[model samples]
Target: MRFALLATTMLAGSALLASCATKEAPVPVTPAAVVEAPAPAPEPAKPAPQLGAFGFDEAGMDKGVSPGDSFYNYANGTWAKNTPIPSDRSNYGMFTVLADLSQKRTQGILEEVKANPNSKIGVAYSTYLDTGTIESKGLAPIQPWLNQVKGLKSKAGYAALLAQADRNGVSIPFGSYVGQDDKNPEVYALNLSQSGLGMPDRDYYLSADAKQVANRAAYEKHLTNVLTLAGEPNAAARAKAILAYETEIARVHWTRVDSRDATKTYNKMTLAELTKKAPGFDFGGYFTGIGAKVDYVLVSQPSAVTGIAKLIRSTPIAVLKDQLLVRSLDRFSAVLPDAFDKENFSFYGTTLSGTPEQQARWKRATDWTAGALEDEVSKIYVAKYYPPETKAVMDEMIKNIIAAMGRRIDALEWMSPETKVKAHAKLAAFTPKIGYPDRWRDYSDLNIVSGDALGNVIRANNWAHEENVNHLGKPLQRWEWGMTPMEVNAYANFGMVEIVFPAAILQPPFFDPNADPAVNYGGIGAVIGHELSHHFDDQGAKYDASGTLTDWWTPADVAAFKARTDALVAQYDLYEPLPGMHVKGALTLGENVGDLAGLTVAYDAYRHSLGGKAAPVIGGYSGDQRFYLGWAQVWRRNFREPAMRQRILTDPHSPSEYRAAVVRNLDPWYAAFAPEAGQKLFLQPDQRVRIW
Candidate 1:
């Protein structure tokens, strides 16, 4: 989704300035007959509520009724029955606002393309954005580029292609390629996940799990589709080619993860060692291509060294032809800013935090979002919006959530004793980053235009990129944060044992000092728990306690986790957004697991924090009920369908409605509040899946 990048701020007008850059419940408690009484009437099949109707006039009576409820029929009742998933989205949410705004902005830009109609950049973007033709065919504008890749016939052709990428400032190393880092050695990094492998991990390729076997079959099919789409005529031959190329890439990819943690411990390294370690692949040429000047390589995964050695030996020069894709990939990657801006305006500009005015003001305030932090504007912004009281509350909430999670971990009967220890250690290792950065990033070198919108943006991004690449060779800047202090998002990076909640998100619907602790705990506190739970989510559990990406869980624990997650995936996959569309549950399992765990742990923390205080009434419902309502209210939003479709294919998070509905459906505490028999939003005792 498009929006501003993490780090600094940009005014919407400033955003508009760079015309060229575009690139930017449950029932419970009551014994058997209470639950059975609700069972006889089929729960009245409450008609699904409209996305806008989720809120009630009361402060907390509208718990499950809030907008942005679950997308699934089972959870959302009548709302799912009547509401249709927009043709353009797989799921829907506040993101639709952002998407619509971007479309309008892009449409304005596109109108300029139509009016002036013929600059190189305009033509390029028009060709890329022509949805009528390209979207139907899955980015068909790249067909000619794909043909060029097909034409390569020899190792020399491959070398020439690599040289071209270097000339064009692209960086490709086996599986992924990034070109912008040519000037800053610290900027280069790869997102190890989402490499388009059907198998869960490299281990699946080498394992005997029946599911893995099926995944291999699916991988072959998926590769066949990609190759065919790329112009390969013979499915069988294309599958072989894709398999061979991917296997080699996976060899390198797997190695990088094998020892990522140890490598992150120290940043001192020589270029000679780096080159010697990963032979065949030309680091000097690659580094030169990206303009990176690293004192030491930031080996995020220590195991990357292992991959370097294996890639040096096992990879064949013949297989290198696939690297030709890197150039186009780099170009596409560059366009991410454009794509993101066009898609996620609401997410970045609205929901996460901030009004359009605030967002616009942010742009003007901390104009250099990417390059520097701790700017005067940022400090002021924090002081204005993120008060010390909120920060203190957040710190306490995190502690409570973590403690609650630990209590849950202690109760896991399925986990082995050894696995539990590792889990606990990982939990302990988690470093919570709340409010703003402890140390602001240095952006003195990045020159902001002050008024030259596009120039300022490019400079800021370039500076940030440089900072990232320079992390190589130097000690791991444990304090170097990834997200801006003012950003509205929160994140859990397993590699770093870090969880971040920026100041922008610490606001209404998430946290309110006057609100009951249950509500706050259910809202932002759950967000914290959700992030923390990532350490043990489906993909996260693969990583070991030290925050290294590894397989530390026992076979049984792994099986149980998957068994539960698989059900969740299937349940979500069945939710048809449009007539024929459904959410890809597997793609979203990691976040879903986090969502489930977050709500559970947050609720537990609330219960413990209450210290036996009676549930006070606020607005018509008890405080217990208000907590759920507060949680739902936070997600209250509406979306245009066109944008919703796009999110389903790309976003990992479920629609806001489903995000709330599913959690409430699984929340054991929800039933305690709304125990009215035969009411909708009540859950059967047998339906619950409590995995925290």
Candidate 2:
């Protein structure tokens, strides 16, 4: 199963360049140096502010369009029209902008570190950039692993090979990971779920849409290319067999919506029970091969596991080995020869996502190094770029949001007093981790060879797997974070009962320190609220304040919550991003809840911050109007058609335009914009749905 975290779902981008200038040695004699006294050092140039005068980008707004008709366009129409998505990107916006800035900063850091021979990050990065070495090495580094697959004698021997694949970061029939046990949040547990599909989601395999059909064909061709490059005979036939095998797995896979349900998906069983439930597969051998010592495991999708295990038993041994080989080649394509990298990207990037070009090699190398040594890079990133004052401001904002949520909960008429008490307890218990983790992850034991790029990658994967396996039978590491400090995203981990904000997300449209109070509130302030509200959203509500999966809501509370959420789903289902593609309301319900509740509470918090005084108008716009605009501008994104279609099918968040339209559900928005009854986004007062 996926990690129990609700993220903002924003795409992260890369950054600019930095260089160090060397100063010539000063003259030994002062008299000789005085021959040309340097002009008074020029006053340092002031850095330009990221946004407009008060944080809102007024120039980006299209005032000709009424806020009611289309608030997103009214706020960001001009910017969207002028800002072309980068050729290497499928979509671009504020998140991408900030991500680019973060990556650029990271690039500078890597460059400095690369000069140090002992720096693991430097050695790893430099090795990845050595295209000549990579080309010369070819498949020599991974040949042993491929040969191991070829040496498999029977279906029973596949368990060990699959375990080795997991360590090397390759896809397998079943995916497993260590996580906080939902029912027992204090102890880590092993989780098993259905996997093996090459596409982003099961929909990609099952959907009969013309685009999906074309994607499947492209994927098959990509597979053939990879197999042929690996010197495998009958590559075309093997590719066809692999696709057929995956399609069978897809038929039994759980839908994203169903898999996300905390109550329905949690099925804990002993080793004996698992073997019995899925009799054909080698459960014991697989667990032992991975060195997992747990007596029991959490089965995310019980029926899917059974179905997949059966398929593993029924599929030909040759076909299974072929699938593993293709997956392995794709996984290490970056460190492999250029042909492997290009073919892998040709399908996954151009065909699946519509990105025209690959990101620069150095940028890709920087990303890989950061991911491989997340904390090492993050520790440096935080020290060089993140300031103490930013975290302090964010801390205060999170507290205010939590207080505002408390007030909202107290005022809820649908919730019973008993349930409200629990809600308050949960709110009070939320652990807001801002900027970075309290302690850094140690990577001293992980080896990084200077010239062996593939070897470094493989070792890093194995080290990470060992780290996760070591977590079993130990207490949860509360200081650990899922995101690095350089990532331009945030998440709410339900099991940990915490909301984490990385250092990189605290700039520009998200949370500029110099921006207006309203803008900050709508930007990061609302983001804080969004993550907090996730704990009370449809699926998250199943977990209690203790971070244990259980029913904490009363019967009446469930009914009322569902009634409101059902209306939200209906509202989103009507949104058509493409000609035939509409938002998956049921799949995206939780995020929609977060957007609605987050914005609503953020508005209340903004009003409260003013101490009941009327907000002053700025630049011919009221504070409420600016607040809404801030929310809209942050979601200003333009997506390529193919990418947009893929997101509609798989992503849990609604399209950016519809997400901005969430303002229509709030009563204050109606007062601020006075959207007429006939406008496209106008909602009747009673038609609005509010739940937090």
Candidate 3:
């Protein structure tokens, strides 16, 4: 969900901006009479590097000062030190600019609505923000619902209610009901993702490695403590309820590795087939509750669904309401967003060349574009904003990125030759989706009328739920894009073997040609590597080239990979940013792996580009050295306590400080940037995690 927002913003970046020029403005005529003006005909042909072009800089490693004093560290560190948190923003990062801008626009809208008390959007906002005070109905809906669920005296009845809640609470449209699928005999296999801690993915909770698991434990405790502050004053009773809720939900919160990519390949199953696999449960009602208007649903394993349904019918409701299940859903909805933002600020924000103003314009345009006016928006954007040169740069960047990925695959050591071949085949099969989608989502059915904020959210969510539910038993649309076209971030779906770069992130500090290659590599190129590496991350590694959730790793290699990943988890676990908050290395292992592997691949690519020739001055540091600095600078951020706490519980990536420190500590390339054998910069030796 954190990445979803990031992806949305990224997609919006490519949308058309509204025309700035007024129709009435007349073109100024050049003066024909001035003698001095005539002399201006021979204006000097000033030589400057073409926009988006970089000139080679020959700077060898420049390491005399401490790493804390490095240019990039100083620039970002200075900002981190001085920038105060704005009241409107919960967290601080480059995207803070976007949020600030959004707030300004939203405030303007709010003011307009306030002036016109009858406006739809105004009413929606008012209602959503009311906290139920308007009608003295604070959480009344929840109370009734809870009571209905609680009234189920029998275990069978209670189990049905719990299953309903699981469906209701699962944040993502596709992931609910996975544990009940008939395919996996291990009922809880899909349910492994739940834990009370507010973070993304189950790996964050279960991994016992040094870096992430340690953080996971601390994060869990800290979050529980925070919740205590928000819970009922009757500590013991509240604790009992919470524990009751947590473990119950965790039991049913199924895990689906790379769900985005794999969704399309799942076949559909009829209600009769589903019933046979898992009897006693009312299959028809469950489908109806899920709003499945269609006859069949896309099922990765019809067998699993049937099996899970059987388990639901047989298992006691108490067992279904396991603490892990409740916590998993709660965390998925609440915590994942903050975790992603904290880990890679630039990945979701200023990594691109565009300004916040430009991004805001893009987002508004894209949101509107997804409606009936999509063609109009696309045409306008292509004609007015999508420059030929920009397209060329994007095309070239994609080519280089894909090529670099091939090189990385060829260089893998632990992978068996057979697996490497398969990896290459997957890479070859990979699809590159850049900028906008070929098919825009069908938003025609959505009605934005009656702008009651609560109504609007409910309608939007209902529409989404209906859309997902309607997919039952239909052929998967391979061409369907998971993210909107104008989002601000990029991602790789390992199941699909596809990488997507939204229009939002293709600009600025991340991609302009004027910036040094070292910076670009550290910025966007490393990001490319990160996404590419996700195909091999702990979870992503579970999915094979066919986009199926099956193990492909050799037994020995899997063990070794886990060991290497475990070490990364340990390294990050020790980092403590606040009084009680700590990084959950297990939760962040995938990202941590991406950070390390991305940097490694990008650095290797950069070195290969130079043919191994040492460079002599980039701001007094070698090109190689500056490359790493540029990487660290991308993650520089600032945040307030509420925002920081929120992110700590939810996000999968480490904090910005750790994003830089943790990755660099494990990277030998960073040592070149701060080449002092015993310097603090070299916190860990290469031998520690020599794995690719």
Candidate 4:
């Protein structure tokens, strides 16, 4: 499923930006039911702020820096300078801070249930933590899968094997999943897209840059390491052949920017049409293998699909089988012996992302358990850590942000009245889901054995695939959510016309109930506005209020929107995070729009919350100044050079520093700091691009 996330990071897993349209009416904005903690005794006075005296971290600021010249530095320069990205992490920021906290909390939850025989979470966690057992088993668990790959006798079996690999959660040349159709929001449809690259993007294989070239070499070495560990014959030669084969796959792959275009990617076709268009490979046998009984499928990146199919038919079966073997080995490396896990991390972590060390085994186990049994973990998470009062507070804040968006839409000068009406309708139709889902996913059928980590993961993957397949011929489950409650991220699902806030993201820096009103507005309030504005962003503008992908805008509206977004793209294009690499402005335009509009509306909401009364000065900073700082601090981050470079090519969000600099486009930000004419980020009033 495609999700317009608040931020994109490898830590959050791969969230391909796409839309999932839903037919359900807008659900009322309300807090989910929570297992409330025992009420605290009434206090005589209010509690202290969570972050600082007034919610902003004054010590983190650099007073020597001019806000206009470098607001991000002014707000977070001291913090960024002193703080180091964790040894096991590619980058560190507020998001990482919270994610670490969530991981610890999940670990605690697992500890409490590890002895419970009926708890799948317990069994999964304990089995993963059993290093001696894993070491003893060696490669025994995955030997059968390897044998299947080695047993491949002809090209005729390619489609079925690839489909089986996909179902078992192994990387393949192409992938398919069941999601709500873009055009038909009411029904679930099978979606296929190009896949198979071991690297983050096609650029890693195709780019001429020195860094990318080095990355390719490192990848091949890593492949050989895995192949040798798996006891393959002529490992080095096979690894080289596998890399050459994948480079061809990368050549046929679509660029990340083009793949993000909903209109271009959404190609509905009959089963026969798919077979005819990509005839070399057997599409029919593949669907049958996946257990997807659909009359038609939505092919994302049709050309890439066709190209990959042709490549599959032409590539040597031995090379293809070798690739599949390496993929399978690497996919389950963590559950394998220590050498395999460390080898996997050496390339993916140190070489690609520049992290010096791997995360602790227990932490990795906790994360895996939580992810494999997400809702089950979340059910306990929300009951313990999530405060019921926090959800209520978030609900009201979301409503305010939604109201703020409505005002912004009504005040748009470039949009025609016809377009404005639909914009308002869509805004009104937004379903804001706060904290957690109202309904929990049932994992009763999932079997997690105590001593079989590999088998458990495979079963869980198959179970998930079956769950997705079951969506076919059934009504859309409106209560379904894309993220678990323990995640530190939030998303705007355009197809559902809903904004989701996971329980874990609601904490210090993003949202603090004890913090000042302005800070909350600038932090989570802006986040809410960001998610809401996504429905009105460049691609999102194509979908109407009902979540149908259509052109509801007039020609003038479309042109006007593009004119502003094009300017945003150009503006971001000038930001050089690294010496030779610049931000991909077109690729990040949707998120940039979200930041610009979200911050603008959030400022408006903060002012409105004051009820026309002047905000009291705290720490000698005015209300607006504190608000802008709040927004900037939330994006405060430090990244390793390699991770920063990789994010430039693969991630949809701009660098955190650039994200914080989004304040340059706002008028209130200028008034708050009074940046001068010669300053770095001082955009002239007329030069500012504003679109809601």
Model 2 residue 409 distance off true place after TM-score fit, in angstroms: 0.5
Winner of 3 and 4 under lDDT: 4
Rank by lDDT, highest first: 2, 4, 1, 3
Q: Against the true structure, what is each candidate's TM-score?
A: 0.57, 0.93, 0.62, 0.93
Ranking by TM-score: 4, 2, 3, 1
> How well is each residue in 536-568 modelled by candidate 3, as lDDT tens digits?
788777766766567677888788788888888
Clashing residue pairs in candidate 2, if any?
Answer: 13-99, 14-100, 15-100, 15-104
For TM-score, candidate 1 versus 4, the one ahead is: 4
On residues 1-692, what C-alpha lDDT tens digit does candidate 4 reach at each position? 12233432322333344443677765554344433444544444557887889888988999899998899999998999999888899999999999999999999999988888777899899998998999999999999999998999999998899889988999988878899899988889999999989999999999999999999999999999999888877999999998998899899899989998999999999999998898789899999999998999999999989998888888899999999998998899999999999999999999999999999989999999988889999999999998888888888888888888888888889999988898889888999998899998889999899999999889989889898899999998999999998899999888899999999999989998889989989999999889988888888888888888988999998899899999999999999999989999999999999999889998998998899999999889899998998999899899999999999999999999899999988988888899999899998999988876
Q: Residue by residue across 1-692, what tens digits does model 2's lDDT show? A: 01234333443443333343547554343332223333555554444457997888989989899989999999999999999999999999999999999999999999998868889999988999999999998899999988999899998789888998998888898999999999999989999998989999998888898888988999999999999999999999999999999999999999998988888889999999999999789988888888899989999999999999999989999999999999999999999999999999898899988999999999999999999999999998999999888888888888888999999999999999999999999988899999999898889999999889999999999999999899998877999999999999899999999999999898889888767789889998889989999999998888888899998899999999999999999999999999988999999999999999999888888989999898899878899988888899889999999899889988999999999999989998898889999899998889888776
Each model's Cα RMSD: 19.3, 12.5, 14.0, 15.3
lDDT of every model, 2 decimals: 0.53, 0.90, 0.51, 0.90
lDDT of 2: 0.90
Q: After superposition, how far is residue 36 of candidate 4 from its true place, in Å?
A: 41
Task: List runs of model 3 lying over 4 Å from the truth.
Answer: 1-65, 68-75, 98-284, 291-391, 579-582, 608-616, 641-650, 662-671, 683-688
Off by over 4 Å in 1: 1-284, 291-377, 448-458, 664-670, 673-684
> Judged by TM-score, which candidate is best?
4
